[model samples]
Target: MRKAAALGVAALALAAQCAAAAVPVQGYAIKATYPHDPQAFTQGLFFKDGFLWESTGQYGASSVRKVELATGKVLQKRALPEKVFGEGIAPHGDSIVGITWMNQAGFVMDQGSLSIKGTFNYMGEGWGLTSDGERLYMSDGTPEIRVLDPKSFGEQRRIKVTVDGQPLAKINELEWVEGQIYANVWQSDRIARIDPFSGRVLGWIDLSGLAATAKAGKDIDNVLNGIAYDAKTRRLFVTGKRWPKLFEIELRPAKK
Candidate 1:
């Protein structure tokens, strides 16, 4: 009886160690707030050449716009066809690429003019897109992140995101930050920092209090979504679908 009890305790200890090995979720400290278009249902956000490029969804309302970060003014805009629901936007070589949800179609546009230059098709639902200067990374509303050939827009490889060896699905918006892939899990206020090569989730950023600060009585789809980073300024920004403000945040190690 004593031997069995000892073995049980040992097993419990082992299990505790395994649980402790799970990656931790970090929290963010808001650094600054910037004006954002409250009507825009932001699906993808990025900073480029002193402008904030955004993709807004909703079939009849979808658009790709370059906005002034301070004034929230649409500097340049391009509307998607009424039937297409825009999902994500990414900057490629000298052009920009925008994807549509469920339509399985994407558009390539001139970065300078935001004019449609060409179109490309893929097989699944488009969710998020980002690039690391050479290759394109995309999410299809699944745990898988597809690496695409920038030239042909063909899938070159895939990385299945996992946290503590368990697959994490609904990986939404994506931003390649400092060699790690930062992703928004749909409907969650947490962002996962993942290893691009290993698909291991290194940590998570919790932005729980952000949406609550929105203007009272403003009815909006407030799920935490957009993520953008400025490598030169080392700034990180996050916002939500129809959120009135964009926040610059700094991540801090979460307390155990």
Candidate 2:
């Protein structure tokens, strides 16, 4: 009887995997294109109030900046210290919170001035970060996302990201868009649209061939890595590290 029950459970799990695998992969329509700094190794991005706030990576080259959307011009910038490699950033009330790659220490910047107001510490590596206006969602290069208190940046809970009942690794550069979490799968050209609560990958935005137009330099690691959405106008944008162009794209129906 015990052996029979174990086989039953395994069959049920396989059925779940098949169902999840049937989730559709989506395509996109390029609504518009704008210039981006090819030198900016984009790590995180958010759109607000007609401007783009971006966080860039690389040791001794990390920075947070406010850029004009139309011209790709950096209007305001603040460079991080040489010792820390920055990862992700999100806005919290009147400030912007930023996380580093491995230092486990993140900083809070005043939104109006881009000045470091304070610092906070966490337990593990920080890769990508986003905000839903209430809580902060942080990814640590694993399949799990840590839900954090926006005020204290304290870990409240975790959500394990999975596709077809399997873990999805190298999740990077997250953005909370229209109640769903859109994440870039590191080193891949596609983005995963995930359910924040269930941690289930609802679908994937297959962005194949989009990167070829960005005119990225010879750095082979400059895969797609940034996403930003404007809540006011509902415009979705995507780009890559050291990419020369940023695209405003509209989602089409999912493909088989």
Candidate 3:
């Protein structure tokens, strides 16, 4: 009887340790605010060389815009062909690449001119994109992230994201921040911070009340999306679809 009791205690201790290994959910504190185009249905966002590059979706209104970080002024803009719905944008070498939803095509543009350089074809839907300077990380609205060669636009590898051993789906707009891949979960106020190599979710950033704080009466799609990190300034920014305000947020560890 004593041996059985000892074995049961060991089992309980092992279970407790396994439970402790689960990742924690976190929240954010707004450090600053910036004016964003209220009409912009942001699907992807990134910062480079002091400018904010944004991609907006919707069949006819899909566009890529380089905006002034502070004033929300569009410095340059290029509209995608009306038939394609824009999804994600990433800096590739001296150029930029933007992907389309459902079209399986991606556009390469000259960074300075924002003019289409060419289009490349891919297999699945493109939901989010980001570059780690060497390779492109892409999400297809599933739990998997594909690593592609920036030059050939060919898939090199894939990572299946999971939180505490459970698959995480609906991964949306992505930004590679401080060596971690940050992705917005579609239709949710949570953002998953994932390990690039292991695909294990390290933590979650919950911005639950953010959209409610938007300008009253402004029309919005009400989904939390879009993440951009300024490596030069080490600033993190987030905005939602059709949200008028952009926020720079600081992460806070959630309580146990």
Best by lDDT: 2
TM-score of 3: 0.90
The window of 10 residues in a row where model 3 has the poorest summed lDDT is: 214-223
Candidate number achieving the greatest TM-score relative to the actual structure? 2
Residue lDDT tens for model 3, 51-159: 9999999989999999999998999999988998999999988899889889999989999999899989999899999999999999999999999999999999999
- Write the residue-wise lDDT of candidate 1 on 23-116 in tens digits: 7878878888888888889999999998899999998999999999888899889988999999989998779988899999999999988889
* Clash count in backbone of candidate 3: 0
Each model's lDDT comes to 0.89, 0.93, 0.90
Off by over 4 Å in 3: 1-21, 216-220
- Candidate 2 lDDT by residue in tens digits, 1-256: 9999999999999998778659888899899999999989999999987899999999999999999999999999999999999999999998999999989899999989999999999988999999999999999999999999988777899999999788999999999998999999999988999899999999999898888877776688788999999999999999999999999999999875
- Residue pairs in clash, model 3: none
Candidate numbers, best lDDT first, in rank order: 2, 3, 1
Worst 10 residues of 2 by lDDT: 213-222
Give stretches of model 2 more than 4 Å off. Answer: 1-21
Q: What is the model-wide C-alpha lDDT for candidate 1?
A: 0.89
